[model samples]
Target: MGWGWLSYSYWFPRVHSQNVPNSALFYPAVDTDVTPCHYRIPAVYSFGSYLFAFCEQRLDTSKDYGRMNIGLRKLCLKDLGRCEDDSEWSKFCQLPLLEGYRTMNPCPVGCKETGKLYVFVSAINAKIHEAEILKGRNTEDFKLFVTSTIDCGESWTPWQDITYNFNENVPVGSKFVVLGPGHGIELHSGRLVVPGYFYRMPSSFTEEILRQMPNGRKSPPYNNVGCSFCLISDDKGETWNISTTSDNFTYCVVDNMYRHMGECTIAETVPGKLLLNSREYGNGQYRILAESEDGGTSWKQGKVCTQLRDPTNRGCKGGLAKLVLEDVRYLIASNCGHPSARKNLTLWISQDDGATWSKPWTVRDRELCGYSDIDTYMDPSTGTAYVAVLYETGVSSYSERIDFISIKFSEVLEKCSY
Candidate 1:
């Protein structure tokens, strides 16, 4: 891609050129003090027709280098769309962010079958890295916290630990897949899909470091990676089959040009096909994409759609929002912000299930980007799309807050112009 902007490559499908700038950008607003760069975001539909934003609030004191926490918020759709003159266009009410986050991860999805929004967040009480500098902390506290809402976002219940055994393992990608919501929907034959993964800590740091991480050392043979397996459930996420390794896929590539497969989100397209989006950090760059037609148990491969490239902006977590606007099935992915320059947020589309894609547009182009995760819902009856993005505003991870890019898919792809 060229600097500032590059003309749509010939490799791109031929389509009319249009500029759609969302209204939400007009008066971007901030809600809380991130303290030390907070941006891994995920959002789902609100009962009130609004959007709920999620992210981790990291607080690292000079003396305490590895300390971190996560939080959530409730925001209106038009707020991120920047559609109105009302001050609420970008306002957020911080919910009781999880306490003692230390090392907590959160992701959410709405299940139309159950009519309740559920979240599969990573919960850890303590994490101890073998590096002499990384000991004494609680290195054994990570569980998935599932919360939900029935009456819009008017209220929320305490987190319910869906994890079967603290030691057995957990199945989580960047976030869990939503077969439906509330209890989740079952197939006609009485089958259901709930995707998650478990991580294996290192046996010892890999030299230079006290104990090598199981996957690899902190620095790596420069390359240390492994895959988490999925734990399936047929009874609406109540009971799960044994965890299984995703056999169809492999770890990310590490060329002199690329680094690793960062964090990610998964989606089910068509009937059995699944798509994965990830955040990679290394070589001072970021890229994302993973696809599987076998129900996320494994995949076909990874596609580095250049259009999804955000040079300097560090992308975080993101989701898939499907739409058949003008006879095309589009999946818009976001990285909150790329580590590269002028490139922050993006919305990409894939016509062939999740196999291939067309050029995507940039949205929520904020400079300070962190864990950028998104989830969208379409009024099945109206085809009105509502997308929510989690992003930071300041200049770096040190300055952050939880804000969303709330807008209708039509308003974004058809009406708004950048």
Candidate 2:
């Protein structure tokens, strides 16, 4: 695989687990047949009594080697077992969600106040080939776009490109921008927020450095550093504002290359405060943390989170969800517990906002586990609550299949040693 992309055989068996007693059900949301290359970056949200899952459907097209498009599959709360039928699930749109562009990172959010669902995606114009990018050819920068639905996942509005809105707020030289690739949150006050990052390209390009570059370089063409921020909407999904970027924070470097903070997750830890958990791309061993006092408008400098570890400096993406159980607010996070390997997918509970976390409960111990998203729902009939996790897993590699696991609140409280 080029550019360190993981490659898995097409014949890998679909692995599903229901061994956990509290897990109501576990199954593979997508297999190799649905996407020949792989189904990557899963995002899920609950709308009414149904759960919707979205992923980047990777396939080879005539123009691009493995072009990606957003694909969706849904499950009914009343009958999780029936999702196995091919006809039960359907795409959010008939054609590619963002046609003609290389789409990635599907971040979906639902607003109870408005009864609408929104999906945010990042795309780069794939005009240049991979070989060209490796050879220091400058490709077009990324653009942010969004789509919304009023009636669950039945239909969606056309893609609304919001690149201009983002570019207007970012610094003049900012080159690329991307969103949560997982799920966003609607604060109790009705404000919506989606965590994201932007890469600031070098101010000036030197011909000498460009000419001296070696072949097969994995980094982008320009010497860029990523900074985390958030996209906030005060008037629902009609408009958005880019929060202050976290560029003042001290970034770590390894091998003379700057490590950038990227792909963050945000949760309203308190009434007016937000906690941003970021992936450290540098020598830092723990996830980066930043605080916002006024909703998502501005952010403080990021610091290393001593408790959360990211081994080998290759930080993995994590999921954060807010749960209120028995009148106590809790924050639950899911990530690979190990620093270096994407194994031991564990869930941690935080009772005092995010100041501290309890011991984690291992969701998947040994197999390959990677990017994950968490969403919660309360059954109206029984008043019982459930948390659904959609993640990447496989027997040999994490890209083999996307899986789902539903666990009850009672099980978490009993298992989590708070």
Candidate 3:
């Protein structure tokens, strides 16, 4: 139990079935502890049978860094384990410019022939670690905000400033960064790979994503730590351009070795053979997949899943949510554990699609501190499997708060297909 203890109480992680084949967990009498679905960078989407937990209701301390205040909650997919009656749950603070501050990191997807649910969030205002160090200093005034929800979570419609010009005349780069996995695939020519991500901020980075330098800080750090593009929204997510990757990876620092591409998520395997699976935090750690047949623009240089472990030994900037159940392939990621240990919060699975990965269990072990997140979904008509995690037990010095867990993959595959 290395750096364990998620504090508070109610814990769950019991899925070994018989001999542990599809091994899964969380059944502490049906999981459920403390929760508003917590947030330290959260985003979960399960649509339909219901499993949507968006975060960052983190009011302000200048913003993002001030942390916690962006809100939206809805749970009822088997109550995710235990505890219920939060007086009949109902939350909504649909980004009123994140009043009081702290936006979030959401990427909801569900377009099954237009069941309608397209959420791609990243609406910021500063403070979240200085909005990634002011997009590495100046990303055209660093202010990110993108919102949409065509009905599935009830209602939410304002805010959608993606700008998305992409011709590069003066686009300053930075948007989406990556929000894959929601199924659109028609491509053989129909065109529809809205996999999102194009970061490289600091042309004055703020003023709510200022269009073209309302005060884009006057442009400075060319590529401090950016570069991740690919946007082709031909009428699904409603329009986007720059289908980059001919040579568009504009931010890299070799020899001394530095890389870019944060918050990625893609999983489509048969149409044009797409597999992107991403999550790499600069300098180097692991969890790369990269393989865009003709869809993600271009990418084919990452095949390391090292059983998933990178608790910040100088690396840990989390984001990775995948799903594929039945054919297997599941992933809900978090960093700061292996050595960097943000107090244990890792989860993994892959019947094969990330090539090779296994043995990364534990929703949030529980010892004494807190900070947790995760999300998963697989329901191509009813294979039924949805996981949503949120744990934050007592802040540093010992005491904060947030806990809510849910897991159901046929009840851990009927107790591990044993």
Candidate 4:
């Protein structure tokens, strides 16, 4: 595992060893402005002739708890798979939220077949923090809301609360669910798959057990039992269902290494097959990988991808995109490459679905890097396909700003020497 990159390069040599610059690098796509806040958790998707980008506009503070809203910008596609300057994306607007609730985790999915775009977010009570809910000290009033657009970000439908329908099918002990902090996918079969995970209350802890337990055990130990599942919609984004697969479920152990899996993203490898990449709630430094055989309804056991290294203690959220060129499919991922620090942002290419990966190509070598989302698009005129990345990065703090970058598929293959 330690020499995974070296072994991959040995098998596939590059014809051109020189560095080929990226197509475009748009810095500060979302930045802290007048009020002094933050823009984090970037999600990008190619819809229509524009690139739809979204992120969390954390007002007052960058902390997870507080006033937050989803901000979006539609970038115009230009020649060679590049987009117009960030300044030209003047349609920057913030979505409306329910009173006393903060909307977050902007997971956008677009259906080319229907020409509809949906953004799914979690509306949480502003007074409650995630820690309080995880520790069982406060029950979070979490609701699911989704809004759609048909005119390419010109206007959006009113927020429709779908909490009841989604909750009714969730597991009995489910605490709450978190949507993709990135983007979702519309499968070839017209299935809308949104990757997410939720925490569940441990059934072993009862009143009798609490009474006999010690002081440390008497207090609600953080409910670390979690399962990664997909929010599936068979008829476009009209209705949804939850997957009850047990393979990706995990409970906290004595070492606290196998905690909850959350902030997941999904990509369809082939027809009816999907790959899920998730962030860990514990100290595991490797990203958890799982596969679904039946279009994200059920998943195989979640295992650590030794090649995909992440920082310990709540692994950072990464992005995954599926690309095909010359009838060959490749899975591209982006995240902070350093094992201990949120720096060294890099891109990895997986030739065999996800079984093996090529050596990483450094994106940002020495700066704070955070959550990222990846999607591929083609130039409307030239038909040149490209891989786009929207990620959080800063010199001092990872959440200080969000940046966007794009590179041609041919150049990516050359740069990574895959």
Candidate 5:
């Protein structure tokens, strides 16, 4: 709640009738059990006729750390690329949890060549909080695992520990590494890219320093740097590589202590070009934008996109997706439109490959919302393109419900009023 200057809210001159789309309550919060549960971090993936929604079911509290499991709901598109009806979605089901560990970050990528759905998750010791990992307290407390479903959501392969592939190539001084916490992308060349970020421990970090720190420090560890990149897999999900080229990593300058990049999303702008959109964690209210020419291997220097405004202090997670309309490409994104608090969930469109974006149209009308994922599909038979969003929204807080909404590309074009 101590958003500080980043909590500056933009109040429009006038309020207009909301152009809300058709949305269904996909994952509603539960208060019936002794341990009330709330769903957060929504990610949506579309494969064939099914669209899968995934989130973290925080049992007992809405805090990041606790007993958490990945919750999934499968929706069948009665008509290809359509899921407006709530009846199309299946009941929410809790995914199998790693014993003694809490599973977070539901990053799923579908393979175009093999038709398999892969979900990457971070398994952490339930007792080990993110603060401990950032402080280098116990590197072994974090691990990365991925599971796949060849038959859609009907079944899944056993979880495979892929931590070695990452741990071995972590940046020289990285301590904390995490997955997309959203949906991943499969490029045209069949390269799978999972958006990720890691924190690099400064040379000043030491056990003695940890002991000397204040009991309840509010700010992040001093001098610790955060960077954003993608995890690449060439031969499906058989093996992986971290994008470590000098140009591949994106982070803000060290002049500001709290200005760090985190929780990013990626999309292929064209055949050989890629765009990585990340949230600036500190007082930087603008969304950070970076580009790569050769898939996810390397990236251009990152710059803040003034067109997209993010709430200050741990900016909310947004979704990115690309769609081709009559040979023209467009990038669609969703996030909190407000500059100060987590409110005014909005949708934006970039026509010139993210060079500029239209003024976003509010999606939630001042409702408290957080974390969203955008996915698009074109009906083969009709050639009609549609975009779908899975997001968390509530009146008083973000821990209310994860909702699903879909609108046509035609509607997006009409709604994106410059």
Candidate 6:
């Protein structure tokens, strides 16, 4: 058990650290006209001896607000520092992962038991308009889909439409549904869970206008209310089901904050227990917590974890993962540790499940550090444990490039200790 370190407050004093030593950063340079922004929500999955990473390659920004195609790259876990040689990374496909629709938020999960990898993605009809949305036209325009790879991402199956699986259980008037822009989880018992959210436009236009208006709102507006949930699949990626959605009313402290449970990440705390850490827009500094005992089919609201504070009250999405070293379980989280800006990208450790966390170990202390994803890679030959974080970083803004940093298990333990 990892309880020996539980007595001490895990929170370390914020230090002006610079970067993780022996880490490499990879940047993909492309002609801006063809690809405007990478729209950094990068996801990494450790399969066998290789690591697969993905991001949204935004194309035609002038026309489409955020029209992008999924771009994938792979690197050997043993050769992290050598990724800078463009030839070392491979871009398997140029065509959009899912065509005809505008896709965002790609969540990738791998099942070692079945040796299959699943990628869950969300898409909205690029041509749909606000007027049509208001009239309940093409309400299913915003949907979730999944594609899988049995050959370690060398090839992928056709995009499978799984929107109906969630729509059947979503609340009335729900107009939007999305999956994690990060990675998903496969429990010890072989159950697959992908974190996601569903939302409906408010009855009154005021809430919608206030929330949607600021982000350069235009003709086709986005939904204002978001309640997080998990898409659970027991039969691998063949079939799926929806979990009980988070209770927004009771979980949120302020009435105005009720509608904004944004992107989420899930990790198994123990044998049968799962913890969900979600991004709350109205209350950005604190992350919302929820728990599920029955394999993510049902969830109970947990209090806000002020110990896990992000930079801004308008919180940005982060990454979470669970690791076991020497039979001691630890949870690792990555996010901007500040409370007002997207800087001080740090990694936090929790020894006692998700109850408490150690002081953050700075990953990158820069202004434009945005969304990130975490995954563990264990070398079978030497039994070495390594954690890799794929995050967004830039000098002036958040969207210049996506970088991958690999930290050894010893490095994490050394930095997390007092």
Q: Evaluate model 5: give its TM-score.
A: 0.89
lDDT of 6 by residue, 1-418 (tens): 7766643234334653557642223344543345334546788878766788887776655132457677777877666542333455564354235666877678888888778988877777777643465456787676677888888777788888887886556655566666897888889888998888755555533454345334432222354555677888888767887754533211333333352676889899997788888877664567777788876877775457877875555688888998998899998888877667776678888898888887667767544677888888776656678888888777786666777777777788678653
Over 148-213, each residue of candidate 3 has an lDDT whose tens digit, in order, gives: 666656666766666445446223444434333222233444455544445555443344333423
lDDT by residue for model 2 over 1-418, one digit each (tens)?
A: 4633332222211122223422212223344344345667878787766788887766664232357777777766665431333344543332245666778789988788788888988876665444343233453445678888887777789988888886567755555567887888888788998888766554422344334334343343345656788888889878887855533222333344445678788889877788888887655567777788888877775666666655445677888888887789988787776656776666777888788776657767666777888877776667678777878777787776677777887776666666
Query: What is residue 270's positional error in candidate 3, in angstroms?
Result: 37
TM-score of 1: 0.65
Residue 172 miss distance in model 4 (angstroms) = 2.3
All candidates: TM-score:
0.65, 0.80, 0.28, 0.85, 0.89, 0.83
For model 6, what is the error of residue 19's alpha carbon versus the real structure, in angstroms, after optimal superposition?
1.0
lDDT of each: 0.45, 0.68, 0.46, 0.74, 0.78, 0.70
Among the numbered candidates, top TM-score falls to: 5
Off by over 4 Å in 3: 1-115, 118-227, 230-251, 260-262, 265-339, 342-418
Reference-based TM-score, model 3: 0.28
Cand. 2 TM to true fold: 0.80
Q: Write the per-residue lDDT of candidate 1 for residues 102-174, one digit (tens) a residue.
A: 4345555455555666555555444533232123233334445666777655567777765444333332322
TM-score between model 4 and native: 0.85
Candidate order by TM-score, decreasing, is 5, 4, 6, 2, 1, 3
Instruction: List candidate 4 stretches off by more than 4 Å.
Output: 1-34, 83-85, 137-140, 204-221, 244-259
Q: Residue 407 in model 2: shift from native, Å? A: 1.0
lDDT, residue 259, model 5 = 50
The candidates, ranked best first by lDDT, are: 5, 4, 6, 2, 3, 1
How much is the lDDT of residue 26 in candidate 3?
16
Scored by Cα lDDT, where does model 3 land?
0.46
